[model samples]
Target: MDLNQMLSEIEGGNDEEIERLLQRYNSENNRTFTFDQKEESLRIKLCQSTLAVLRREVPFSCQRTCLETLRIMSRDKCVLSPVATREGILTLSLSQNGLQEDNLSEEEERVVVEALKCLCNVMFNSPTAQQICVDVQLAPVLCGKLHSADTWHHEVGLFTLRLLFLLSALRPDLRMCLRKDCQAVTLLTKMLEHTLDINWWLTFTAENNERVMEALKALFNLTLNEPEGEEDVRQCRVIVSLLRHVLMLKTETVEKTEELHSHAVNLLNNLPVSCLDGAGRPACASASENLKVKPEIGNTMRNKLVRLMTHVDWGFDIMSGCEEEPRPNPSEDMTEEQKEYEAEKLFKIITELTRHDMIRPMVVRPDGQLGSLEDKLREIANDDDEANNSDSD
Candidate 1:
């Protein structure tokens, strides 16, 4: 079977022809696969038509085959090449059409979303596909579609985000590709905003929520190391709102899901001072007391989020003190403004590191941040003493 011909059929949603081609290709490729389950599994990926075919077959009884086919495709690099990308683009285009066909049930829609997710593994993570994303103008198109109220379009939109999520986990450097697009930040933050619609994309139970989480994670990784500017303030606001939304969830399982909590911490880690109110409201407000993040609470957030990471992955631990410390003013330590300032600074650093690179500080040997931070603290501690002496004078 010809590869281009198979791709055309996939574009048209013809599954049988693609399957026939797959079985024949597998027969030829089968001999090459060694029987150890892991290696044997890699053999299943040998056929070029496998991912495209399984994506179409997702609704059929053989769903497991497609799932495994995609899983295998993700593990290897060859599946991400140009030819595979054409197949993925065609797959998503086909997914767009399927959304309009009312004859399909929600179950089948889910199958397609899952299939699109498979296609995204290549689009977001595959280095080969990076050029394709720019050539095809994929990021903005997908972000726009994500906002569609139509269910089918919405699902396809979410499917697009799933690709972004994989890109972050599998290829940390590709995040710059997204930042180049002027709309990328707003596109990502919109998904994070607290929605009046419980069924909206970010809500945990919503069908599209997984895609939202994927984008959130990817955006978190993308901005982790990025420097602060005017927009960093808004980014922090968007994150705090997301945290409030997650904490508001009534379900113990969902709220406490190790995943969601980690997300909360990730946002907190990158919280910037510009975005934080001295008082710690969603935005700075004159009405409230300052937001205080106790040192222990910060430590707890780090511990809970680390479960998602591996031992080799670095920079999870964060300890901070006020900058320009050792102040002569006793009033500084107890104020709400001071407390919120410290929390914002700590979160911002974590956020920067999380967004830019997976590597965190090893910290076995000090970066020597502690001693400098301690002296600053000592100066701040003298604020009251200095003030009393001045008053006496």
Candidate 2:
């Protein structure tokens, strides 16, 4: 049937026809299903019908199919305007009422997962959807759902984390809400520990790794532009410890390790520097001794920070030495812009480390063989002066 005819039948309350049309559209192998941009009215109608089906007391199969179809359709930004509405968001979000109750059957869990997937797609593609998500206060609801241990092991938890990441990344207000209202830093930290199996023995699997990555990303967004209140400082200390564990994780490959470490670094860079006094110190001697944290974990973190500082120093040396080498085109591996950005983060981190009386000794080893942090800062200042002089010339 044509798109209009199918949507018409769905609007006419033909439940079987609606299920068939949704299945056909949502099929992975069905390459023939494509919605024309001109048929926007039909798309809106389709979203409305699917949302209605989700709201109705439909069978699990029907509800699942509707959610899956909405997920696929939401990929097109054009179809998202209607889906981004307040009512539309609530209908899809509330479809998983079982999630709030912590008593979902297997079938109900499937529907909830699909609903979350749809919500993720919608929120990702539409800023309107993102704003509406904040207005509807969906973060607290998702946070509440995440409190359940059962949700952590399932796709529901993963999608919920993904949604939270998108929401916080896109909406600054939601980040504060998550950090203050949801206590997301601690929640996500616990989730990270759980995913890494830190309490027991470490279990390195692809599934847990992705979960860890998502949790790290969400934590990064939550901590961005955060003020350093007493509570924030305490929370950051805990995160610094968790990041040390992340750096020490054994991924399947060197490349995977680097990728995960890059994310961990980005998050570590976002944390307030005041809380970093304990970053380079040993954790085993502290109160966490009861947790059996290895002493080397702290050393690993220290070494990682020093390596980044050294990398930044080396980059500056090369730039100063090769004054005549025409700046090369930005490459996929590390663009010139990205190099400067990374160097800046490393410089700031190292500069902050130098302020700590104890950390300064570890970070600034002045044996005359390695340049001190002060020397690097002077070199950076000289380079800036040279750039300004060259621009004036």
Candidate 3:
């Protein structure tokens, strides 16, 4: 049956029609499921029917189907206006009581996950929905959900982290609220450590990797453009340490490993220089060695020096080898422009690393089998000069 017919039947209290429609929609390729602007009335009717189904006591399967359908429909901005209303947001946002309880059945959990996914799409595509989220104080509620141990589930935590990231990214006021008021930094860092299994041992399963990546993205958003206070610095230290572990994790493929590292590096770039003492330490040895040594400024600076030098060396290797051995897969290769951009980011980071007293020696070390930071910087400068000369010619 067509969506119009199914939705009409749904409004007539035939919940089974919604499930059939949902199955049909799910079977079709999602890319083909566009909600055209011309179909505004149909979209509105569909939204009303779904929300109505959610408001009434229906089978959990029916509710989930309605929510899942809405989640797909909300991807289109044209359909979002009707779905972004206060009533719509409230109906879709999982009930605080339901989320708080640990004994929820699998069917009930599926409904909650679908609801959160729907909210994510709504918040992502509509400013109206974002403001409504704030008006309803959704950020604190999400934080509270994460804060409670009972409410934790893999899918629930992942989507919740995603929603929190969107709120922090889209709204400036909520960043501080998430940071100071919600204590999101500490909470997210703990989540990352848990996913990484940092305390017990490193565990790099796909599920945990995805959760850690979302937590990292959210952390990057939360810390963006915010000045670090003493408390913030302390929290950042713990995060950087966890991120160090993230860097060392070997995923199933080289590309996946690089992707994870890229996220880790982006977050590291935002952190304060003081907090980066944790970043420079050897990822594998950090947990044990940290327990053995009392942290001092000298040791911290030395670690930073070694870490910066390591980055410089790694950057040099990539730059030198890019031409000698072209990657077999053209799609996987970094473009020259992208390589240059990454090089610029590295230069900026290395430059910042040099501001400390201990980092100076590493930068100026003489070129040899173990190349120095100065040599890498000089090589990068010569390459830039050659590129500029060629462009001018």
In model 2, the runs with Cα more than 4 Å from the true position are 28-35, 100-103, 149-151, 198-203, 253-255, 281-315, 318-393
Best by lDDT: 2
Off by over 4 Å in 1: 1-46, 49-111, 123-125, 149-158, 168-182, 194-212, 225-232, 248-256, 278-393
lDDT per model vs. reference: 0.52, 0.74, 0.73
* Candidates arranged by TM-score, highest first: 2, 3, 1
What TM-score would candidate 1 get against the native? 0.50
Ranking by lDDT: 2, 3, 1
Q: Which lDDT tens digits does candidate 1 get at residues 133-249?
A: 555655555555545424334665566666556644555555565655535556666665533245433435644455445666767766766445666566667666666555444
For candidate 1, give the lDDT of residue 46. Answer: 44
- Name the candidate, 1 or 2, with the larger TM-score value: 2
- The C-alpha stretches of model 3 lying farther than 4 A from their native spots are 25-33, 95-97, 149-151, 198-203, 226-228, 281-393
| Worst 10 contiguous positions by lDDT, candidate 2 | 314-323
- What are the clashing pairs of model 2? none
Q: Number of the top candidate by TM-score?
A: 2
